[model samples]
Target chain A: MAANQEEVKLLGVVGSPFVCRVRIALKFKGIEYEFLEENLANKSDLLLKYNPVHKKVPVFVHNEKPIAESLVIVEYIDETWNNNPILPSDPYQKALARFWSKFIDDKVVGAAWKSAFTVDEKERGKNVQEALEGLQFLEDEIKEKKFFGGEEIGLVDIAGVFIAFWIPIVQEIAGLQLFSSEKFPNLYKWSQELINHSVVKEVLPPREPLFAFFKGRYESLIASQ
Target chain B: MAANQEEVKLLGVVGSPFVCRVRIALKFKGIEYEFLEENLANKSDLLLKYNPVHKKVPVFVHNEKPIAESLVIVEYIDETWNNNPILPSDPYQKALARFWSKFIDDKVVGAAWKSAFTVDEKERGKNVQEALEGLQFLEDEIKEKKFFGGEEIGLVDIAGVFIAFWIPIVQEIAGLQLFSSEKFPNLYKWSQELINHSVVKEVLPPREPLFAFFKGRYESLIASQ
Candidate 1:
């Protein structure tokens, strides 16, 4: 690392898969950065000041310039570091990559996770079924490719960090099984490949602690109901 | 246009600001393509085949490849064409452009429009207040720049096509004058400039029909409550 390299800083919360995406991207590019853990319960002034609009982590600040939105931040990392490109160079292929990434964020993580956390028992079942249907779409998408990027863990793979790591914890907490080998073999295999990747392995939180945290939340949610 | 150029097509609905984003992008790049109007009431097989996941409009097809999501499609168009760039070339600037574009889409259009369309009178006031706060943030962002892209109408401007053209009609339909010149002077001025731009003017549906269409819907909404 050169002394003149722009100082890169990441403000993030633990167990946030969005933050993990940035961490993986930074490691893949082998860029050094200072990581500031933000207590989302009581957000720090730095986090508030930098990302006032969303006021959420992870906010990636490079040389004092703040960029919010995890996917947008990952693209910034790819653009800044020339080696080991994450997005495709071709216009059409790049569009495809971005399309999938947005699908994962919008449908898979956003909609699926909300459905998994539903308080009503009957609605929970219905929501979970819909979420799985969405996952099935992704499973079909990755049928032949080694990764969503085809040969490497690229934008789509990074966007799916939650599915690879956090979904199991969510499933355990909610006492539901969403991913099955027979039902979504490709997605299951892809999750294993993603979690085992050296860069990903370093950023993922330990499962036991994550399980305990979410378990308490789920219990409280059920009790409140 | 070259005879050998891939057959480009857009799947869209009339009065959809999202579909308008794609239309403006195509015209800006001088790309010739067929526009297939999808009866959203009864969607076509082509729309379902190309964008089964979202089952929504503004799907851009180049050759045989289909791309969904308006911002993604706009970026694709910018990348494919070498001239009249929509996104900034520099990585940091490009990231900034994307950030604002997403902000407008997610916060401004998403929240503001929902508030403006609120049925209950009391909740409508509260929602409108929150929506105005979001618009205030955007107003501050564009305080110095002629457009969010600084000098040119770029990706952010394209992403905010709704605010430029659709919102005034929404105001008329909902009977809510949210974009007061005194409150959001900069944004008001920008909206005028954007609507009057040659490329934007070419695609904007005439105001009278748009108003009549939204008025009928608003009447049904109010009557239902």
Candidate 2:
């Protein structure tokens, strides 16, 4: 059963994949949450007080206790809820899930940021190549699995929410091509399936609006450059 | 209650803080394992097979199943051994533990690397200041606690093995100082206590040899530059 909104609250900015991943976890566990929109330009005192170190968004506050860091929040959710488990049960499998998720965070998302977000043309080219190499690793890892977790969305699958949803949107506007069916069929299919997953699709921001925001942001960067 | 050497093996090189932390975790849980040395310059096929993704060391193999990543290995040890509980039981506290360790990895250790390892003199100064600022956060966080885990060495304390042992050695040889008794008194005290902890002390490489290794490595970088 879902908890009431008053007991469970989430503070985050819209369009953030970190926040998106957290929401997916909440919904997966049938946990009801009150989403408090945060303005990144002017960070709220609550956000700062809860997460003094990073001062970033996606703070999940349950009964006034805040949990920061998306992955940490997700793990906390799994640990606390203890239903529809997001991470594997076995020690070794759980370790692999953690390992692959870290790889995604450290390698794939990192390279994707440089490739599509940076204003430097040279850096874009370099990171484009880097992102492609990283995608190859994912392609091989995912293989023919429906998801990284095999027929379910779990830590690695949700950790890769960015690659599943954001990359294509950003790459198109930034005039880049990195992930595609031709290069990585299995990985691409899994990504497509992930975004379209019922739980994931419900919480995802409207595609067109999200795309427009990035489009404008990308153009603004280029215009300013 | 510990697994035997044939059933449990660790592949790594000496002087890697990642490997050192895993050793601390194993000792905490009383896991018996054989150590397999790897020549990083020419990585062994066994290491390659175990950790093809990162190709880094500290691969903990239990029952022929390999687990990569230092923190992941530590978690696996805690989960499998089910003794000397390294992480906090509460979900919120666990999240905080994860967050702080990441802060150590992303902020303090990152800055320390640039400060002491980089050839660029200007970069070193900037990163030296950065590292000191990071240490200030740690000092504040540690305030009056015996360990980050409080009353016992846990995930955060073990994760900070690099700061406790490696930083002092590297900074001295590299002609830099970011963490010390004067600047971060509380954190420095914790570091000293952690390094001297019986379990950690037994596994640590000798100071003289470790110092000499970094000194040679640092001088080589400067000589090449």
Across the candidates, what are chain A's individual TM-scores?
Answer: 0.95, 0.96
lDDT against the true structure, each candidate = 0.87, 0.89
Q: Which residue pairs does candidate 2 place in steric collision?
A: none
- Please provide TM-scores, in order, for all candidate models, with all chains considered together: 0.95, 0.97
Error of 1 at B211 (Å): 1.0
After TM-score superposition, what is the CA distance of residue A88 in candidate 2 from its true location, in Å? 1.1
Model 2, span B71-153: residue lDDT tens? 88888888888778998888788888888888888888889978988887788888988888878888999999999999999
Query: Per-residue alpha-carbon lDDT of model 1 for B71-141, expressed as tens digits?
Result: 99999999888678899999889998999888888767866677667787788787687768878988998
User: Can you write out model 2's per-residue Cα lDDT over A127-191, one digit (the tens) per residue?
Assistant: 88888888999999999899988889999999999998899898888877888888899999999
- Docking quality band of candidate 2, CAPRI definitions: high
Candidate 1, residue B87: how far the Cα is off, in Å: 0.6
Error of 1 at B130 (Å): 3.5
Question: After superposition on all CA atoms, how large is the RMSD of candidate 2?
Answer: 1.5
Query: Against the true structure, what is every candidate's RMSD?
Result: 1.9, 1.5
